[model samples]
Target: MTSKIAVLGAGSWGSVLASVLDENGHDVRLWSYNKEQVDLFNSTHTNPHYIKDHTFSKTLVAYNDLAEAIDGAEYILFVVPTQVTRSVAKQVAEILEKNNQKVDLIHASKGIEEGTYMRLSEVLAEEIKPANRNSISVISGPSHAEDAIRKDITLVTVASRNLGDAERVQHLFMNSYFRVYTSDDVIGVEIGAALKNIIAIGAGALNGLGYKDNAKAALMTRGLAEISRLGTSFGANPLTFIGLSGVGDIIVTGTSTNSRNWRAGNELGQGKSLDEVIDNMGMVIEGIATTKAAYELSKKRGVDMPITSAIYHVLYDNADIKETINQLMTREGRSELS
Candidate 1:
């Protein structure tokens, strides 16, 4: 079933989704904040900003205006960074609401906002009035932009408050190589999506420290343990963290050098400060904020997230990496699966 899909943000992930939908015979409109990037999509049929080698389909259209992008959109996918989801949603809501239009929404972003600590859904609920909240969903999992663009077999989950809507979203993007699953666990989905980056940074740091797979595996596993401890406090299903969005995402992001979070962590592990690493990456690494948020969350929930706490100290408190590792190792011994 062909549908009208609008993808906001022309970054790697957004462009990949646009290309995927276009290849699936849907009417895809890709919205970009950068006018020159939009022009590149319009003229050369390539998104040089993200995927330079892959040719975008003719069915894909680029628009600089939000109105043009969401015009009659059946599914509006916001692919912006977590920090900007609210602002972008506000703009989207104003534009669509003014036009007397309503569309199903799916967010591909992952990260809780700083001060508000609002999950993407909370941000949507805030930007969109009560009337439009039900239309929003979050699609996330192990798929990376680079792999998705190459037509690899990528699997992800679309979580919605409404199970039917989740199913609708799942069906909307299921193609030969792209498989979509439906989940009603929005918190589990979003938390897993957001928290994995923190662990990825830890993994990257491990790599930078020339640590072994045993260390990476331990960090990755414990990372999710803490993620769930906090997620459960926020009403997420404890088991959902074991699913694709949780453990699945953690494994992929934590290990992949292509991951911005991991790359940033690698630099951090190599002795660069947070400012220096982020400056070099030249992009928003969600893990840094997530690490901070996780620190707060762990305190609030009384969950002993030693790993997350160590990460917080290393990043913001100037704790040495070797010292952090020693602290983690020296913590009171406990069963692995308690």
Candidate 2:
């Protein structure tokens, strides 16, 4: 039952997932784009930048070469940023073509490409060669890398066009602390995973502005509504939004201080500039780019995503946050169901 798995991206999430797979008795090869990171992991079994407190599983291996990490592996799990997924996929495709290898592709990143507005799975499908496509799946939910490293109980949904593919991934990662649920609704799962980050920013912003629990509660509720609307407009199952990838994700990201998007939004609400927030974060704040993509996609699809639009204005156009909140509050009242 053990499989050779190549885990790309060496970030906190990637390292933690590789660790989890190793714990599950898999042969894991962790890959990083940076040579120094690979060296650090190989020498000390620790990633000071991302997971400084914990050492990696002794059975897990690290590699700087993508081809070396992917060679002879049966699965390739992508944990890189969404914006760079296409490029990494292209490289993986080239390597697969060269070696005549095919493997299942899984991605955990959550974000939509800015201009193309393609979901992470879509980006993989477009970039990866068809011959190398075994099946593509996305594993996502409210899970964060920090808690995941601590073996905190986490539940995530795995989605694919093929039911068997989803089940295969479920068996691979399911454990006492880590649980996996299967769904065929890739559109809903990915949409929920991507859009919730934007709303989390708004939630954090509200908190930073000294808004009470009432305001945060209202923002999260309305945020879910708009998320459902946009997701359904894209042919996603409305019910899927009620699942882990949807409301479950919103609850965690929107409320937790560990969320990068929420943290960035909080800083912005405290009167810091977006650039300052991002620079201070030092990690990719996915919501910043995803907000623009969601806003543009909502308009193109004729879906009313007022919260997304408002966040987009604040982040991209330097719109005043207080004025933006007032404008949102003043919008003509509608039925709660609407």
Candidate 3:
């Protein structure tokens, strides 16, 4: 069946994913908050600000009006920054109620809400009225729009509490170049997605500090251990950490030059201030907020996430990177098998 998909937040990932869906023969309507961006996408079929020089699918449409975007769409995919997800959800809820529409919700954003510390799906549940909503699914992994645009072999997971919904998204997005896997472990997928960015910041800092490959490897390895510890505390399957949504995401976000979180961390390691990094990136770095939430959650849950705490202090408290690294290394030595 030719399904109608509405994609909210026409950023790099959102735009690219819309194009991918359209390429897979679905009718896609992309929504942008900025009227100028919507007009540009409609006129030129390109989002120069984010995915420059890449042309969009000919059948894909862009809209500035939320109502138009959601009109008759079967699935609504949100790729907005995590911080603004609630506001967007409220707006979507209003539109859905007014139009008497019930649609499946899918979010590709990765972050924990700063104050509430809620995952993206949780935020959606809180804001979107149940009667107007259907199944909720999250699509996350190591997939980057830059690489996906080039038709690279990308693997990601579609997770939901509802297995049928996960399978639906999996089938919708799956293709030769982009493979999709389904899982019922939404918490694991989300935690892995949110927390990996924090580790990537540490990894990027290591690179910025002129550390070698061994240091990066150690950071990635220990990073996963801490992520697994914290995720399991939240009722997530421990094995999910080793899956595409967990380790796969950390490796890509931690290592890729295409990763905004990594680039932000690299800048921090090279001596850029948080304000300076935010001003320069011109995009929301999910790790900054996720780091704060993860640190707070670790403390609340009594989970030992030393690396996450260190990154939180560096970003929030202006802790010295070298000093933090020394403190971590000089801490009472423990067995790696622990």
lDDT of each: 0.88, 0.92, 0.93
* lDDT at residue 214 of model 1 (Cα atoms): 94
Q: Residues 1-338, candidate 2: write the lDDT tens digits.
A: 99999999999889999999999999999999999989989988999788768987778889999999999999999999988998999999999999999999999999999899999999999988779979999998878888988989999999998989999999999899999999999999999999999999999999899998999999998999999999998889999999999999999999998898899989999999988998899889988899999999999999998999999999989999999999999999899997
Worst 10 residues of 1 by lDDT: 127-136
Better by lDDT, candidate 2 or 1: 2
lDDT of 3: 0.93
Roughly what TM-score does model 2 have, to 2 decimal places?
0.98
> TM-score of each candidate?
0.96, 0.98, 0.98
Across residues 168-243, which tens digit of lDDT does each residue of candidate 1 receive? 8887788999999899999989999998998999999999999999999989999999889889888999988999
Distance (Å) between predicted and true CA of 234, model 2?
Answer: 1.3
Residue pair clashes in candidate 3: none
Which wins on lDDT, candidate 1 or candidate 3? 3
Reference-based lDDT, residue 172, model 1: 74
